[model samples]
Every structure is written in structure tokens, then in C-alpha cells.
Target: FADLKRDRHDDETINTVFRSVHSIKGGAGAFGHERLQHFSHHYETLLDLIRNGTLPLSEPLIDLIVAAFDTLADHVI
Candidate 1:
């Protein structure tokens, strides 16, 4: 994850990160963690923006979403 952050100029890395967030959102919703669901949904929306090229996948954006994943995991557990 850290390596990806350092080299986010690579399209593949960004897409891989987006897919990971998407999977977490699905699992979080499946486990019925409303907070995780909410957070992941919001986080996914942000990723969608990047995936669609509507928004640039900047370092701060990546960092924020990565942190959101931790929060989602905490809520799930």
C-alpha cells in the first residue's frame, strides 16, 4: 500500500486500490456494519470518481481512502 502511494502515477496501482476498496465495501455491507457501510459507500464514491477519471487520484486522496479502510475494518470486527 505504501509503495502504491509513492507511485500512484501508475494506472494499474490506482485501479488495484480501487478494487480493494470496492471489495471491502461489499463485505462490510454483508456483515451489517452500518457505519462501515456508510463509510465504505462514501469512500467508494470517491474511488469511483478516480476510476472514471473525473477526479485525479492524488496522494492525499489515496491516503484518506486507505485510512477509511482501516475504519471500515474496525467497524466490521
Candidate 2:
């Protein structure tokens, strides 16, 4: 989140976020957390788009992504 706050367009940061979310999705699936898995799948898709240059890193989108991260954290707890 700090990386994103500093520079949402940074490729390294975007890739890191994508990988982390993908790992979370895998763990969620292994643990039978279907809702989390589903959410992370969609979140991963969004990150993928950003990483692939298909989506521009807009401020509103960054806000949404951060909120999604918060949601994922909520689920984990």
C-alpha cells in the first residue's frame, strides 16, 4: 500500500501487488475460503490489467484498489 501510495504506476510495485494477491487467492482456495478466493480472483484480474498496460493507474482506481485490500485484510482476520 505504501508503494502504491507513493507511485501507483510503478511496474515493480504493481507486479508485487499482483503476485501477493495471487498468492492470497491460492491460499484461500486451499483453505476452502470460496468467497475470498472469488474476491481475490477478481482483484487479481484488475491488477493484471494494470500490470499489462490495459488499465491506466487512475487515482480513483487506486482508491478502489486500496479499499479492496482493506476488504481482503478484513476477511483474513
Candidate 3:
């Protein structure tokens, strides 16, 4: 998340973030944590858009991603 905050437009960071969230989503699904899996699915979708150049990186989008990370972290804990 810190890396994303620092470089929201960086492809490498975006891919890393996507993979992290994807892993979380997969684990959540495997563990039958439906809510976490759902949230991460949507979050991953957004990252996918960014990665595919369908969505432009903006301050608001970055903020949203950061906030989602917080939510996901809370779920993990």
C-alpha cells in the first residue's frame, strides 16, 4: 500500500498490489470467508482496470485503494 501511495501509476507496483489482493481473495475463498473474498474480488477488478489501462490513476482512486487495503487488513486480523 505504501508503494502504491508513492507511485500509483507504476506498472510494477500496480501488478504487485493486484497479486497481493488476488492472493488474499484466493485464500479467503479457500477458507470460506465469503465477505473477504467478495470484497477482494471487487478490489481486484479495479486493479485490473488500472493494469489494463482502462482506468486512469488519480488521487481519488489511489485513496480508495488505500482505504480498501485498510478494510482488507481489518478482515485479516
Q: Which structure among the candidates has the greatest lDDT? A: 3
Off by over 4 Å in 1: none
Error (Å) of candidate 1 at residue 7 is 2.8
lDDT, candidate 3, residue 74? 91
Determine which window of 10 residues in candidate 3 has minimal summed lDDT: 1-10
TM-score of each: 0.71, 0.90, 0.90
How would you encode candidate 2's per-residue C-alpha lDDT over 1-77 as one tens digit per residue? 77677673568888888898999999999999999999999999999999898998987888899999899988887
Model 3: pairs clashing at backbone N, Cα or C within 3 Å = none
Per-residue lDDT of candidate 1, residues 1-77 (tens digit): 67656763566666786787778778877888677667778887887787789997667877886787687667656
Q: How does each model score on lDDT?
A: 0.74, 0.89, 0.90
Of 1 and 3, the candidate ahead on TM-score is: 3
Between candidates 1 and 2, name the one with more favorable TM-score.
2
Write down the lDDT that model 2 would get.
Answer: 0.89
Give, for candidate 1, the lowest lDDT window spanning 10 residues: 4-13
Candidate 3: global Cα-lDDT?
A: 0.90
